[model samples]
Target: MAKAFASQGDMSEKKTSFTEIGEGLYAFTAEGDPNSGVIIGDDSVMIIEAQATPRLAQKVIDCVRSVTDKPISHVVLTHYHAVRVLGASAFGADQIIMSDKARAMVVERGQEDWDSEFQRFPRLFEGHESIPGLTWPTTTFSDSMTVYLGKRKVVIKQIGRAHTAGDSVIWVPDQQTMFTGDIVEYHSACYCGDGHYEDWGATLDAVKAYDPQSIAPGRGDALVGRDMVDAALTNTRDFVDSTYNAVKPVAARGGSLKDAWDAVRDACDPKFRDYAIYEHCLPFNVARAYDEARGIDTPRIWTAQRDLEMWEQLQG
Candidate 1:
């Protein structure tokens, strides 16, 4: 039988875990589901990566309420993906911030992404109807921006691109803890459909410079110790590096996309096959890597229709 398309078979909900990785820092993660980070500053709170919809986001809000009474002042998007940004409205945050590139991506392909991702993972979009259309940023920054919730400092920076063109990571200078959006994943598959594979390695180098004592990645469990953080970073890099290395040569040899996909899947499976979303991400991962290797600098927008078409043409 032919393989199913992206996430069509992944409708079951995984258990959600909310962990405090550091003092005032929380990670709201579901087993393999998209995760969000919470930061409590002096007098206010900031949420990183909103869940998919208002109803779902309310669950995160409830979690926040249980711990801190500080109002959610900002909803920071580490990147522009429907699963990551659409739940912003639910937070009632005064400011919604994203890297300028990420905001631009919303204007360019927000609707298409909303539709594409919803169709791909119906389970994650449980409150789909509650979404108030495409989520927009109240503020945007280029290289980096800092916001203070009272006296605490939250640094947000666009550290190259890995998951998407306009990816950003939140750094807490004093604590030396970082919330690296999709740029760095832990024991979970990295979705490279909208990624910049060649530049991704360099971006990881930037993430390493922060030397975060703890890290809240875009998905999976939070990395709690410096050693664990480093391991996750290295593991993430290896995933991206292996994908590019396996596919780059296939493109260089003018091999078929299938050849590139098979090569990468075969090479990466031994290490990453058990990781979350590995199967769902493989086709898109290979497709994007092949494009990068063949000199396509930018990633193409993935529409719901295109997703299925790509699956049939490649995975099928």
Candidate 2:
């Protein structure tokens, strides 16, 4: 059996850590758990990336209440991943926003993703029964959209495909802060089972263009300064590049999937060994990188059975 890590009970009582990235912007992280951000405006608040369930979201709500009671008027989803969006209903925001492509992905494969993720990582979805259904966005835009919170401007843009086809980032120009959903992870493993390795590099470049002073990633510690921000981006890029390159030659030579996995372990295990979820992410990342290197453009849907099949094939 896989060795169990620390459980949520060990960390649940810990106070939610919120750091001010800019004047009125904060990043809420829970001891390397999935991250959620808050952009406090003059009158209302905009929350980025809801937690996994209403119960878990209540923790975030408590944190928000500690700061301001302006009422969370907007909830923005950087993508349609279950962990990032399933708890959206808890916020009771007037508007739930996402990319137009993200909304389509929700309609197309959201249910499949929900099942796949629940099976893959059971720990994150505490109180899963409370989730009403797949999260649907009340508003969606293609490319970019800018909303004014009173006078504060918050720009949401679909920079490029990285973590998912519909990945997005929220930029607060005044704050020089960016909330990059899963596009950039700090110490946490980059879950690339459904990612686009070829397009991920360019997406990182697009995120860099904003020159964010601070960044709230999907997981791990929030990047608080310029040096930390650069390091996060660079480390994430290295992780993705290594995974892709490790599997490329094997896929190109028509080697078996096992061959690609071996190559990936040899290339990445040493460096990424201590990162969170490294073991869980490696098999899936190698599988997707192998497929993409072999010219598979779209990622295959991951069902529970398919996950086990892939794991058995690669790691058994």
Candidate 3:
């Protein structure tokens, strides 16, 4: 019989693949791990989302080096997750950029999130010690910022709060390709522990408005072609909606967290059971959804101890 439950710590295996998604654009996804995006321009390069550690980011650097010797002058943080931003030092990019809100999140919860995530997923942080403290953004924007990669335009915008309070997406208008950090996920489960469910749907709608021909999501494989792009957006929206709606009524009834978890699992498991990280994210997703349903505007901080306590309450 197949195993029914696995710890988050057990799924940290890394997978590295550099796939060319468009002209001068590539996606480096590590088997369900945090992904990094590469934008090769006329004279320089910009990397979106540094991996968890210097060692991991170095692997991506090696791949980028294979194509061009142009220096990586910019590193863009789509959000301030430890797994994504801690490796900024590895790129040695002169300017590390982020949305204004993302930088604030780092100041507010950077240390807590760092401690929480390192404990939960060890393998992702292959060289945790090499991470020289928390990553700080050198530049930040409120709504949108347009960067020129030696004449190639890459627009970075804070579409809305979906995955985190300060989520941003990088759009390559000429190529009709967008690199959405955690705002959009394909195949892999959406991590909603620090997300805003109501805002997430609106953000997805905004992404759809761009009509991207290709999208490199925060995780899973890159979506190519219009059909595939639409499918990815649709599936992500559906997952978020279904999960939120399933737990809303239970939360409204003032039901136990366990009850809400069961409600969401019953509704989502049939179709999403085989999806990557579905089982692992369900408990946390339901917890957040339940909190949101009760008019909790902000997601409570998730500490390492809180993670285990919540897991036991819902999964036990």
| lDDT, candidate 2, 62-176, per-residue tens | 8889889898999999998898999999999999999999999898889988887787777778899999999999999999999899999999999899999999899999979
RMSD to truth, every model: 1.1, 2.4, 2.3
lDDT string for model 3 (170-275, tens) is 9998899999998888888898989999899899999999999999999888888998888889889989999999989998788989999888888889878877
Q: Candidate 2 — which residues are off by over 4 angstroms? A: 1-16
lDDT of each: 0.90, 0.89, 0.89
Could you tell me how far off, in angstroms, the CA of residue 16 lies in candidate 1 after the best superposition? 1.2
Regions of candidate 3 where Cα sits further than 4 Å from its true position: 1-12
Off by over 4 Å in 1: none
C-alpha TM-score for every candidate: 0.98, 0.95, 0.96
Could you give candidate 1's per-residue lDDT for residues 1-316 as a string of tens digits? 4566657888786888899988899999998888999999998999999989998899899999999998999999998899999989999999999988999999999999999988888888987899988999999999999999888899999879889989999998878899998888989999999999888999999999888899999989988998899889999999999999999889999998889988997899999999999988998899899888999998988998888787777854
